[model samples]
Target: MFRISQYLRELAQAQATGSYPTPRERHAKGPVVIWNLIRRCNLTCKHCYALSADHDYAGELSLPEVFTVMDDLKAFGVPALILSGGEPLLRPDLFEIAARARDLGFYTGLSTNGTLIDAPMAARIAGAGFDYVGISLDGLKPTHDKFRRLDGAFDRSLAAIRHLATHNVKVGLRFTMTALNAHDLPALLQLMQDEGANKFYFSHLNYAGRGNIHRDKDAHHQATRTAMDLLFDHAWAAAQAGSLDDYVSGNNDADGPYLLQWVRQHLPQWEEALRQRLVAWGGNASGQMVANIDNLGHVHPDTMWWHHDLGSVRARPFSQIWNDTSDPLMAGLKQRPRPVQGRCASCQYLSICNGNTRVRAQQLTGNPWFEDPGCYLSDAEVGAVSTPFETPANKHARRTIEIAHV
Candidate 1:
């Protein structure tokens, strides 16, 4: 994840320890696990990475099984638990698991589609003591309803946000950007302010599950650049105005170097310092710092790797499964410099992006180590061979930079 708000606001100085100063760049004590508590959802979202349906999925982990995993995670030194699902709220034992997680001293968070979170539900969420609650909103009412494939979804979700804020539950907006919803980002940011949302997460749509089926909707590189520019401007302005809102982007690690380029143009004096920080951030953590557990207790490197199963927690303890590295995929993911091919192999900013998202490469090329097709960076920016997806604007910008150097 790229912490745009932190970078723009300078919320914390990079703690230079040896070469890797940032906590993320340093070796983490344990992975932050994103646990899919259930596979049932009320609304069938167009880009549902879990491809959730209205009905319950068979063979999900039972309450006892969940408790066992929680204990294992706590004992294994897992720092945080992000409880997600088709819609985590649909889980019957959602609060029970959450309360238990808190008792176990885990920093737990809830990821939900806010349509189900009414006033009472919001109150329950606050009582459960979640450190954070992220609600997915694709766009403004009309567009969001279309993407959600349900009428009144937008209104219900908006109400849920207000309800969360009323109960003092720290809530944030989680928007998966696509060609279908990129136009609404500015309005969504406005909604964040109007609703007193504490954070905004701009997720680049990854090619997984339903998202893959609709890959044509992924935003164009030019559109992505435009969106990032808007976000940077808004975040910096908010910081100047003393607003303590947070902004994060995920799925595509290219945002890291993109942010650095933004800094070079807007805050040239701090460019070198930011580069060091990015290096320490260590790009994408995937199998290293980030992990995933599906509803059936299957372990994966990350949430997007739903198709790749490392091991089942029932058969093997999560701690053992995560550390074994016997699985070739897991072994490759754990490698510091992943054996990525094509453009990723030679990108100058490999340390900052870790070859972007490997899942994208795997989805398109049937090779986990291939270059990420979703990367929006130009050949010039990454200092690699010519990129096939380069836009005319990238060429213009490169030419302008060349002229200035001369």
Candidate 2:
């Protein structure tokens, strides 16, 4: 995640103390785990990465099973836990699991579609001592309902936000951008301000599950750039005004470099310092610094790698599976200066993006190391203008290696 507000407001302090995003010290301990507590959701979001439905999925971890995994995660030195699901509130044991996680000292968060967060639910969530609750909102009423496929989902979710805020819970808005909702971003930002939200998360659409089927709906490159510019403008203005509302974006790692370019154009004096800090940030930490545990105890490099399992937490401790690095996919992902091919291999800002999202490449080209189709930066912006172009044979060789590794 790119912490736009943090960088804009606290860059100097972060640089001085080495407490930036993807902090090295914290990463050394363990990855932040996004654990899907269940696979049942009331709403069928069009871009659902889990392809979740309302019915209970077979083999979902029971309360006792989740307790065991929480013990293992805490012992593994996992610093934080983001409890998620098709919609986590549907689980009968949601609060029980969350309460246990809090007792174990995990910086527990709840990622839910806020339609379920009523007054009672809000109180329970606040009582659970959740660090934050991220409620997904695709757009304004009409657009959001269209994407969510429910007529009143927008009202229910908006009410959920208000309910959480009334309880003094830190509530953030999570938006997954697409062509359908790109125009609503400005209004969403306004909504965040009007609702006194603690954070606003802009997620770039990735190709996975239902999202893969809807890839054409992904926002155009120019639209994405415009959105990033809007974010920069808002974040910078907030920083100047002493508003600490957190602004962040996820899925696209190129956002780091894009933000740097924004700084170059707007805050030129801080360009070099921010560049060095981003280099230290070391871009995408999928298989290493981020991880996912699905509803049934399978572990992934990150949430996006649902199709690629490293191992099952039921079979082995998460620490062992994460540190094993025996699996070729794990080894490749954990490797520094990852063996990325094509334009990614030559991009000067590769350090800032780490080849962007590998899953996108894997989805499109059947090779995880190939250049991510989602990277929107131009060759000139990335300083790859004079690099040797990748040939068909080179592409073929990469594919061969990928096949062998898998």
Candidate 3:
């Protein structure tokens, strides 16, 4: 994930000459862990990648087992642990686990649906010393309620956000973009500003679990560009106003190139600096810098790869699973220059995006090496004539045309 608001502030306001700071770079010693403590949720959201339900899942790691895994992760030098779930607050020992992770010196965060966080819950979360809490709210009342598959969910979620804010829990808003709710983005941004949210995370819809069923509803190319423009504008304004400076986009490393293009056109003077910073950030660090331990203790490269298990914490320690290069998928992901195929293999920004999201490619084409179908950039924008599916192009002519347009 990239914080566009911070980048814009550092570029235009601070005029900093050095590289932009990144969580990945700052915590170079260990990978960020997404630990799904539970798999039960009250609401069946349309874009739920976990495919979670209201019922309890069998084989969840026991409390002692979870503690053992947490200890191992801490010993392995994991810097941050994000407690996620169908709804993490639903767990009986949620706060206890969070407190334990904090005590173990891990920067703990919570990912939730927000409906379950009442006043008491908010206080407990704040007391647990959670570094951050990200609550998902798709849109305004009607839209959000529909997406969440429940009426009054919007109000409940908003109440939770307000309650968290009152307790000074450092809460943020998480909105997953799709064709059904993209139009509500402006209103959601205003809501964030009005609610005094500390951050805003705009997640592009990824095809996994229930999300795969809605892939057809993912934002189109032009719509995605327009939405990004709105986000950049809003984030830039927020930065200038000295409020809500953390604006992030996730599940799409194409966003990096998109932002670079935006800076080139709007903030031309800082383009080179932003480019250098982005390159250093080294996009899509799924297998290398991020890992997921599901509720059942299966280890994946990232949270979205529940279908692709690299190893199991129940079988081997997370350190051993992460360090082992025996798994073909894990080994390929660790390779600096991955052996990607199609447009990804030819992309000039390979160093910047690291082949984008492999999971998306694998889902769409049934091959991880194939280019990500979610990449919305045009051939001209990516400095390519065509992809494998498109007609072969005259490279010189295409380059001349693109240069002239620029």
Candidate 4:
């Protein structure tokens, strides 16, 4: 059985002792809570959901407010808080706030537009004792500016990233991939190569932002579909060729192994061929792909569509905010725990909790995130990875699909 009990137990003990747990300790041991200090940003990206005019959030988290959240989270035992915003630096008291959080024993971090990250500012942050930072770099320069709308945003951001790197600050690149940047995958990869960014998360743009929210769905989706095809084609091709193996080789042991094994199984003979393709793929796809906080305190998780209470974040006594009882989008949350059977019940990852965003999934597929798309066996020792196909059925149904042609 897939029991995460051990994982949970280890996490609890680590937090209790103020020492990070094993697997999590190796990387980031925290549950990663986002503090939306504000929502107003100088550059308007159209893909923002909480950007609507109606979304009114207090400009900043007051010291008392910040203290409340920190104390609560500390009590509840969340290990970290990632402070983001329309721009976190926009709030003048950022360092003080961060210092307070750090003093409270919560691992404090920041996400920024990089426009404000200077040597002095960086020093303040380092002195304030933030653990890490995430920098947004959609492309080298041209593409990034087009999306962020600041003329020199890309160069400045890149400069900030390099500056942080020089200061020995750990940084990760944030790439929100979109239909526009979708075809430019290779370009993005090259930029990352130049930047020495170790972590890359690809996200799809969502419908909420300043962009064409009410635009033609078919056309937009089609363009996205086309872009995805091109992007995945390169990815698949890279896997087919030897290009992926090279990237995997470049990836440190832990970093590249999963991607390598995943490609080996999915692309098979062309695994090396897949690696050969040159990629400048756009950075992480954008929008609702991952939940974020706005300048205000709206803590939104990408998978769920609801405004989570910031106080409840990392705060146990505050109670869980997104539980079905409190979330507006999840009317069915407490309805009943649907009994699983057949494929879902017996599947390896049966304790699957990841579901689609309530609003988007309901509107798009009328079905929530019922499938775990990223559940491939990335570790070679896990055994063969399989895709749905016509073959001898493992379990019978009137009509059946089997794991075939792995």
User: For model 3, what is the error of residue 370's alpha carbon versus the real structure, in angstroms, after optimal superposition?
Assistant: 0.7
What is the per-residue lDDT of model 3 for residues 115-186, given as tens digits with 9 covering 90 to 100? Answer: 988899888888889999999999999999999999999999999999999988888899999999999999
Please, what is the whole-model Cα lDDT of each candidate in the order they appear? 0.88, 0.87, 0.86, 0.48
Query: Which structure is stronger by TM-score: 1 or 2?
Result: 2
lDDT of 2 by residue, 4-69 (tens): 887888654444456544433444488899998888999889999899998989998878878888
Runs with alpha carbons beyond 4 Å of true place in candidate 1:
11-28, 386-406
TM-score, model 4 to reference:
0.60
Model 1: per-residue lDDT, tens digit, 233-254?
8888877676789989999999
Residue-level error in angstroms, candidate 3, position 87? 0.7
Q: Rank order by TM-score, top first?
A: 3, 2, 1, 4
Which numbered prediction scores highest in lDDT against the true structure?
1
TM-scores across all candidates?
0.91, 0.92, 0.92, 0.60
Q: Order the candidates by lDDT, highest first — what do you get?
A: 1, 2, 3, 4
TM-score of 3: 0.92
* Model 2, C-alpha of 283: deviation from truth (Å): 1.0
